[model samples]
Target: MTERSYNSLLSTGRIAGLELSNRVFLPAMDMNLCVEGEISDGEIAHYTARAAGGTAMVITGTGAVAWPVGATSRHQPAFSDDRFIPGIRRLADSVHAAGGRLCMQLCHHGKTASVDTADGRPQLVPSLLEGGADMSALRDNPMDELMRLATATHGKKATYKVADEDDLAWVVDQFAAAARRVKAAGVDAIEIHAAHGYLLSSFLSRTYNKRDDRWGGSIENRARLTCEVVRAVKATVGREYPVIVRVNGHEYGAADGLTAAETAEAAAMIQAAGADAIHVSANAHNPFADFTDGPLPNTVAAYREHTKTIKRAVTIPVVAVGRMLPEVADEMIAAGECDFVSMGRQLLADPDLVNKIRAGERRSVRPCINCYVCVEQNFFDGNPKCAVNPALCNEKVAVLTPIARAQHVVVIGGGPGGMEAARVAATRGAKVTLIEKGGRLGGTMWFSQLTTPANAMLVDWLTHEIERLDVDVLTNTVADVELVASLRPDVVIVATGARRGRPAIPGAEMPHVLTGDGLRAVITGDADADLGSIGGLGRVAVGVGRAIGLLNDADRIRRLSKVWMPVGRRVVVIGGGLVGLELAEYLAERGRLVTVLEEGKHLGLPMAMPRRWTAVRKAAEHGVTLVREATPVSISKVAVRYRVGGDEFEVRGDSVVIASEVCADTSFADQLAARGLNVKVVGDAANVGYIEGAMHSAHEVAREL
Candidate 1:
């Protein structure tokens, strides 16, 4: 890579007269640190951390410009009252002190706002349609009266009144007044939140805006309200102060909503009406709109593509957003796709992303793997967290301060958990030794990298971190009881991971049968070649005769390509978890007739909701047969028998893959405990769960140590 200076991104780009020291922008994210609509110290610290991290501008969470019905949540911050000016001023001052600019994203929540009114009253929208409100809350309510109750609960019965033409004008004036107050508070910029299915977004979208008046008909008419708000903010703050608008490049709904082309025209209008820049996003109301759950790694490309259109239509700079990796962001800027990159979850994942990049310490920079857990927490868990970087939300409490009593530590695994523990311990000034039986550090991640490219990033990150921390890495050196005792570390982290539990099913012990891990090892050419030859099996049929019986057709082909197969084309996958589903899809893609026999009622039930839904949808689209509420009873050379609904059925298949149980091996921990060794267990060896749990547990154990 040719070395080039980032002087432009590092220096402030002028929007009217407001100056930002850099182009790094922290997009809006609800910190959920507000108490009764008042910004708490936690919220202040959260924004302050971003500013301190050297962000050029910090955009506060959606601050309601309109009162009552326009607010999304009771706890969401508001700019409607001057009482917030003091708090806002404090935030601005903190940002300014950190050499950063501060901006508030003014918003209105339309129909999707929480219906819990201040005085126990109802909510309101442009239309009083039932089931039109955000359906997330309805999942917990009873089905019988859910829609009716939601409609009634969301009806404006108290402070919120249906907005008429005059009401719309009044709301516009309110935004202008709020802008004036924010400018007075020393905020460098003001952003209009016209995206994410908020009130402004609803008007821009054809689905929410049903009014036949000038604010509802065509795309231009629907966008009139947002344009007016932008113009009002510009008028109030004067042309010297920067004012940006965030808009959805595309709304994913059946309604003939604004397309990227239409959104570009609207953005141009907003710019022409005095907006300084346009920030592009997608998926208006979806809680996981950050593109974490999407299949693509370059989520920002969607926005970047649309920003190109908007850039052509407008004179102002376009800000692109999505799941933008730092490298991708730099490319976008280099290519002139967007003048600025608006990062939300990525910044939350690693506030020091830009700082690390500037220092040429890319390895030290944590990567956002696009897990929607951050958004999921905000929408459901009520607290956002980054899976990779545990110090995200609780930064004030989780800084990388040196341990008071650093000691020698031995991590007995080379997987994600062990690697994380070793890295953290080494960083905290501990003498760390990481022992792995394998030659490489990543363990199962080696297999994961083949399945998903983004997972490769984790391996790279872990490898880089391990090298940076200078931990002693002993590859192909398994730590035995004698060896561990001889090392005599102050602490022992047992992250030996889990072993594939071979169930006592028929033919499970057959030489033809292999475990999923065994298959992956063989497929990746990392398996001991001697093992396959020692069994006197010329070429093992690496197909359905595998453990967990979840090797899909594609995986079978990949495996068989290494060891030729004379078996039939039929296959049966026994598990419906993420692994099983993925295998099934792989098999079906290769023209193999695949049947997934899941013991659970729902396929991929163990996966997170967002991931499970996407997996299930993909499985369905791939024509993979699903036999839920079924368990495999037996597997034979020509056929597999399973029971579903108390009925036994034999499905003929060329091979059977077992995708079921995995057991954690903690015998090492027991032995160490018996020997009076200080030991902490982590990852699958402690609890069989997702990568998030494993990484989190390892980090926690290291922190405690």
Candidate 2:
């Protein structure tokens, strides 16, 4: 085969005094892979995997610049003292051995630092203000001056001692000291964390900093602390070591927030003050901030637009983030919109993304679905976990290499689990066959893809993997006892999936109503003939009928309403999972008065925290009324009956949509068992979990097989 010639992202790349092998960089991500401010063997292995996979420059997770005051969590690593040097040294050495450059990100959480990690230290800031400090940064003061600022409020301790000029200087000095330590650890470069509303970012935004001093006036004033810190670190580390600043190009909500031009000005000041480059991202503190979307949100292309503006304004290289794909990165670099690409969650999904591109194995690259599990994990789960990459935060575990003895594997159901099993088994040199009752792969995901744009990536990723591994797919073929007996494999994996159970309520047999699966069939034009008897059959109704329950049907109503009753002017969605909430938002956007009623105490309980918050906020913003702690007792033609707080209430709606409860398919499992073949259920087949669980289960089962 002819060698493919391409511009190397690693070769001839230099930022500040440190040289990089490529333009691809692993942006800082909170993996929670560290062990008590130290790098664990898993952290080492995880990073080493990325380096070995061919990342030119790997930036370690955020390292605290100031011990207790700056650290966000107990699991985060610290670069404040010589004690951390050995672990960092090993990380840098490992990257170097893999022919990759390594950079350490010096971070200070500021008000975001949790009190647990602060060890009773006060979370100080430029000003003591509301929304300025939370429980995460609350600190106890022993000093008389600081003690006076402590107040008991709402059964909690609140401190109001603002950080004076002296305090600011001390923080800057701590950052400089941390930088020097990182350099001493033999790391190639240092990146300052000024994004994500951290201490430096809080100072840069007017929303967080309300001081009337020089640091609180204009954009220049707000940016003064950042510039000072950059200069101090540069001076402390000497001229040769590279220093980069990671900053948000836009703060998203604050009207007085820094704009692209102001961000450029700050970047220029940092560069002139000895900074090497600017890693540009967006502020996601506000629900409205564009960056608050998932890692690979559908609007990623729009996010990349801001990078172009910042790149044009700055002289130093600009590292652009915000769900950038390899092709997108190439285009941005080729267009001079960004000098390098920084990917946080994308790297977590596939550390070898760059290598896969270089090897022309793009199909093998795992795509981030932008579900926000990683972010949710960092915030609520106390660790970062990727939905697509189970080994992401737990890279300390041994990578499962192919077993010496390969077994013939039978994977039932062509969803994520089955596909993953087949792919991994095939990779291990096992003979694999993936069987799906439907004519295509992506079982329940097919329905989800229809309703949500973010979920479309799931279908794409699964299909890519199935094809790349050359899994023998037998679609539209039900796996029965005769079939399994004929195939007779060493291991049978039953991902047969689940089915919608009979609704144990009155009107459950209503022809007008539909299950999630039935709705999906209606929306996707795959409705079984059984649904044909529903009244009000017309083009519009049929179209909607065809797309009834598919998750991604942006136009199901429009397509079917012409023949059927136009999607009722008023709509009510039951359940508050990702599907229910998203459908409510979609319908509300289309001018429908939407109401969502959930039986849970909180809306979006089924979803992970941060993502659930994001979805709930979006639904509320779209004028969708969410009724939590309410159970729908009955759905009538004119109103939805529900019980909340032991009180009965009714919501009027023309059309009622059921968004809760997914039925798992278990026929294949029963059939496999009847055949006396060893079978293991995974994904939605075992229980209704997210794609991450399914893929992880599949991978685990494949290893055993």
Candidate 3:
């Protein structure tokens, strides 16, 4: 808790001649904040906010060394020409003015170049990679189809010719030129992107580099290209300037991927080539693998082992990244596993994470839930966005100034949206009162957290902020028109949330049938199990589950929730939406034979392609049966009957779950608006959406108030 205790992470350090105020660096993340090769005002504002948030160093994401030919994404920043220097210089000056150092990442997408954006030029690669599976390949499972679609649309495509000696020399020169441009821009340091299956990384790994020439086969030969680039960059930027190279510890998907041993050898070679530091990352070449930016749940801090291996191999400083929490990062530094710690999504979730940690207000720091919204947005050709932090990447809109006059505000429902509305309004000098019908502040989040425990962090943060900002929180208070009118509020925000609708199927009212929320409540002991005629065994399971819930350990409860849920040995879920599939997976993981029936053509239709792929894969891995185009007509004691493709089919399960749907219950909004009050609706109350939409709507309404 003391500054001295955080010496390893918060201590001042140097990279070559560049001095970093602290070891916390904002890892380079592609925000798609630029147009062509020029950094826009939005991009400058984005970096400026992070710098002002107390980042010691900020690495600008993926600036292309060669436009059109080597570009990865259409909107990635470009450093291919000297003409772009002025715009980057402005960014550098802004960050420096905020007392933070800036670094430019020079990249050549190489084999990863998008064919549509390559101006019909052949891509340069270490070797012409042989094609694997067909782009349109399909399998019996829905996950394969989703993965194929995600890969075809989201993954970059290119036609490549193996790089000859002349071509390699030209690329080296391009790297040198890009370094010079960055140096001229007044940037503090440069990072050579030799990782994440980029041009340089493609040469460093045997998976792509099969050439027999000076740059392929053995690890030494495969690493030659990276060494050359580092030398060229150092030479052009002058020996005193700092040069860092990013390398992957594991390619994740490649059959003979670059392992940690090979990666460490590559790092040693790069260090020997005069590089100042090694920025370690893992998982590329596989869309399904967690990329740290939006990591999979079980893979938290996934790349720490890689960083440790590389750090032990080389004398140069190593940067560790991979969904690292502040305390975890500090321990890693103190343990000498890595010299510097970088966080991408965490910084996006809370720009002031480093500042909060420094001030010993660690509880106030917002945690990234690893929902992958940030990475998903970028892959879909949108700017980076956070689910919990709606104002992220929109710093201008997030800026809050005090209102002219303080006014009374009423926030209905203590969900994320309502709580955020109260927090923002109260911060801007408003008398805020938040009313929750339940004893808890988090509304639906309390149920949702059972499926994903990470959400508890957001719930805790919002609750903490509401209390800290002095918002009058009234729990167990059923809000009504009469109660709201009695408060005499200037503005009323309805974030009362939505309700799940059970399907009108045969035998729906059977004691064994339950809504998704009802099942979760029974498992967590929020609802009485004895109310349902679920027999003695079910009652005992519910009792045990309630006991675990009383422990108040979200992670532990989430792990054993399925055991507490009083479902029969066989589980039948009547929907294939996000919640339905996740529930099916949870049940299947706990040894239940689960079948998911959905009328929709695909599962998780609203989710991003990559995330959907992961979800469907998870379902398959858990042996959860997914049946598309299936409409449930009846649920009996023995089985569930469904119509699929004009045929009736039945699957037996002990209990039927109506995970069918939810709709925005705007009854309160309609009622409050009828009273002639200045009313606003947010979160599920407005759109029946997720965290991102909820927070964005709340921020929008609160600012206006």
Give per-model TM-scores.
Answer: 0.87, 0.89, 0.94
Per residue, candidate 3 scores C-alpha lDDT tens digits across 122-211 of 677887766653322122236644454344125434456788999889889999988888899999999999888788988888888888
Cα lDDT of model 2 by residue, 437-526, tens digit:
775667767666544555667677778876767778887787777787688788888886656542455654555455665555555554
Better of 2 and 3 by lDDT: 3
Q: Supply the TM-score for candidate 1.
A: 0.87
Residue ranges of candidate 1 with Cα displaced over 4 Å: 1-8, 116-124, 127-163, 253-255, 284-300, 510-513, 528-569
* Model 1 agreement with the true structure over 1-705: per-residue lDDT tens digits: 544456555656666676766677898888766665666677777888888887878898887775444666656677778887887787788778877788888877765566335346444455444353343422322343334333423444433345688868877898898898888888888899888776788788776677788888787888898989988888788877889899888765335756789898888788778898898876643433223322122344556677777777888888878777666777777777788887777788778767776776766767676555565554441557777878766776467668788688999988889999998888889999999987577877656644444566787798898898889999888788889989989999999888775557786655434467655644444432223521334234332234434332334435554344332368777787867887777667667688888887666654554555556666767888888788778777777788888789998776566677776779999999889999999998999765676789999999877
Candidate 3 Cα errors over 4 Å, as ranges? 1-5, 115-118, 133-157, 288-298, 527-552, 559-564
How far is 347's C-alpha from truth in model 1 (Å)? 1.5
Top TM-score prediction, candidate number? 3
How many Å off is the CA of 673 in candidate 3? 2.2
For residue 92, what is the lDDT in candidate 2? 81
- Top model number, lDDT: 3
